[model samples]
Target: MKSYIAAAIQMTSVPDLQKNLVQAEELIELAKGRGAELVCLPENFAFMGEEKDKIAQAEVIAQSSEKFLKTMAQRFQVTILGGGFPVPVSTGKFYNTALLIDPSGQALARYEKVHLFDVNLPDGNTYRESSTVMAGNRIPPVAPTKELGNLGLSVCYDVRFPELYRHLSQMGADVLFVPAAFTAYTGKDHWQVLIQARAIENTCYVIAPAQTGNHYGMRHTHGHATIVDPWGTILADAGDKPGVAIAEINPIRLEQVRRQMPSLQHRVF
Candidate 1:
């Protein structure tokens, strides 16, 4: 079957690791119970805190070894994509990384946030992500999936750059994951549009899980977790709340759309 059930998990992450993990576990279980074969969590699913202060608590990938990611994938017997965790790279540098775990709880791929969220929105939501988060040099596209043919891995802010999605489409990615923790100000206006645009342009399914509601320190995120089909159709959407948006990833439909439009082939720029 070309169709697979997937879930977009939304949550308000806090600074405490245990608290966020608990929430993640609960939501993952809920999604599994609802028959989700592939579940995705929001950006900074572990901890979302202040600039440099947060980086101090970052963990090394090798030494830390994602216990929560592995446990959830194995327990649910589903593929889990844990979005944006702070991982220490060197003495001071850190990477905002996402991990993709297989049903067997094995880590399939890791994609660091190539484009950091470094913007000062008019609503006083100022962020300087590059201050502590090291930039990723590589663009990881199309991680292998048992259900979806090839899934492109991307995090928040990265969705703004169409070139990334174009590259992934060129790499034969049928589905793309864009887990984000966008601020309320920007998300309200740009989130859905960007998502649909990506899906339509690439002729691929876009699965975007987001952080909704107020988080730790009263920081609010624009939650409207959405799943868009290749035709720019919003299959499932979650408004300003913490919940799951479940949808079916149909590769055949994607192929049909690509065959009809063939935009990826018509790219001259």
Candidate 2:
């Protein structure tokens, strides 16, 4: 199969949804210009605030998300992997959603974040994503399209669980999407290692977009959006800045790696 390029967009989102969309639009254009056929965005790329605060921003997504992403993808003729958005299902509760838009401007796949970040950090920051964000029950592998290859769709906290990636790889995933807004404290130590490890073990490509820098309030993230190859090579690394990490995804290389190791086929249990 022929090789193609993908992009990972890093951002620092605030409380304003419009402003974040504008920034994302510009970055998407940049990725297109870089010849990125598939572009992924970071988690919470729309609005980042308290659980109750996101609900207020949730109602507008159903309309704006499709309209805006569809237009952008169709115009660019590139597959756009939209970042996480808040979709309200009930009063004061919403699911963190990730969408994949085809070049034809249709949402081909939508995967809600299965794992939520609910923990206390060394910096004394406590995040209870379950309080407002309802976790998704299903794990949908992004079906292969003519433009983009087979992808396993997932969100930020999901990367911590290798079992999920193993299942995805077994399900015929050629690539993996791990869009996250990793906190500064944890990311500083564990981010790159985990991302590379996933790719190496699964023998599949990994595309990870991230939120970087300090936000509207005291919130901060370690923004190192990156792409990894099947052999655990760091293909592209977007340093702690709002930018795009562009890299080529070669199916030939993926096959070569898998053939060399054959670990997936040798699994006993």
* Top-TM-score candidate index: 2
For each candidate, give its TM-score against the true structure: 0.95, 0.97
Model 1 stretches with alpha carbons more than 4 Å out: 60-65
- Residues 115-221, model 2: lDDT tens digits: 88889987999988998888999975656765456878889889999999998898888899999999999999999999999999999999999999998566899
* Model 1 TM-score relative to the real fold: 0.95
Worst 10 residues of 1 by lDDT: 56-65
lDDT of 2 at 200: 91
Question: How many residue pairs collide in each prediction?
Answer: 0, 0
Clashing pairs in 1: none
Q: Write the per-residue lDDT of candidate 1 for residues 135-249, one digit (tens) a residue.
A: 8989875786656679889999999999999889889888899999988898888999999999998898999999998876647899988999999999999787778999988
